[model samples]
Target: MTDDYILVLYYSRHGATAEMARHIARGVEMHGVEARLRTVPAVSADCEALSDSIPAQGAPYASLDDLKNCAGLALGSPTRFGNMAAPLKYFLDGTSNLWLTGSLVGKPAGVFTSTASLHGGQESTLLSMLLPLLHHGMLVAGLPYSESALVETHGGGTPYGASHHAGADGKRALDEHEITLCRALGQRLATIALKLGNDRGPNR
Candidate 1:
């Protein structure tokens, strides 16, 4: 309803996931939809711990309004033992209001992740991220084999969604295939979101 935008929400520790978010945002824009980039703060063990209202750098923190108004969603995170990072999970846990309102129902969503090791559960992480979207009644979109990169990627790319292998030191950049798949996923979600929005019509 806010002029057709896709929300690229993510939590990045070593910056790999942030880079992936950027590529995905580019793909969303390619479909003539605005891409809103946002990130969540890291969780702290201290009961009194709290992050600044604004992040020191990179994208600002996300709000429930961003999620509720998004025509589509692209979620990214660094893999944590085959699950999404706690920061992202924490933010999502707070979206129960949206869930209760069914604000995100029927929206398009996609997931992506970065792992430190090649076998460090990239696909599992992507799948785990999809669970909440499904609960929100989102229509999930994944990269198909037609993306070519899903077959050609030596580093990272998957039918589940886009992914990247950041290596043990976490310095590795996204390869051509990973980048390609990220964009492909974003484009697919954006295109689908547009079609769904059109179907809803101005009066609906």
Candidate 2:
């Protein structure tokens, strides 16, 4: 059987959220769990045209099977007016089949976001992203007070989830506290997933 993996799925327009996804994946792998990084294609106004099957660079496009099969999930997106980007939402909308199958029930899930301003809806975006996962019956995970980075962060660490302040020009890199929170979120999700897996066993 294939080893269990956490799905690190995201859609990034300006690359800030993609960078955060990388850090989250790094944290996931550090916890002795596999992290499968995947991205969604940009949506086009013209439905007649199709996107390339493979992305130009970075992680490959995510398949529904990927989400359904994951041991856990860490979703990320750049803020789009207090919500997830259209492409990410579009991809998620297709997962209704998985929802019907109850494929993600009881799995641990987390959300992350990157915003252009400190008040540009990072927490709101993260919360919005969690809605679908909650509907799928996944156990939503959040960063806890025990994570020192959450207490010390001046940039983007929050108890809600990992976040980054990309600044007005979207040029600011993730701060140290932001990075720490990203890792903490990943490790926490992986640890919860492992425990759930043990509890369920092969019969599940």
Candidate 3:
């Protein structure tokens, strides 16, 4: 009974990751679960720099309550030198409070990422996002070989998570395979989340 929703939280620098999030949300809704899309503000070099309470465009900034109450999670980020982007990491780092309270324990979670180059650490970036979720005691769900797009995709798709290659110019749109995988990931996570039912834990 925790809200019947999966929180799709992410940070996109060049829009590729945001597009992936949209596809994933569609998949989540396909499974009859609400997909709550939220994003983090960009990190700034100036310590005092601040963004408007409402962003100029795109999803609203995520609050701790968003992650805490979700039935599931789909975390996405752009690759930052084989890791998750700083903005997403910064947001996750603040969730220690939730971790201590077991807020996310027993929830289903998955990761996705977009990269500017082929072989630019899509898998590594996805794995990097997974670490924090693991620490939160959430159940990690990943795409399997059963997803044909994973094998057929020359651009971006993986067993770990959905991904996209934005090319060196950061403008390549997600191909059909990548979009399929993204939707598949969302659908898979939503399916698991519905079956999970509010973190009440096993019937015991």
Tell me how many clashing residue pairs each candidate has.
0, 0, 0
- Model 3 pairs whose backbones collide: none
Q: Itemize residue pairs with steric clashes in candidate 1.
A: none
lDDT of each: 0.90, 0.89, 0.90
Error of 1 at 196 (Å): 1.0
Candidate 2 lDDT, tens digit per residue, 77-108? 99999999888999998999998888888889
Off by more than 4 A, model 1: 47-50, 200-204
lDDT tens readout by residue for model 1, 68-186:
87888999999999999988988989999988888888888999999999989999999999999999988899999988889988999888899999999999988988888999988
TM-score of 2: 0.94
**Candidate 1 displacement at residue 103 in angstroms:** 0.3
Question: What C-alpha root-mean-square deviation, in Å, does candidate 2 show against the real structure?
Answer: 1.8
Minimal lDDT window, size 10, model 3: 195-204
How does candidate 1 score on lDDT? 0.90
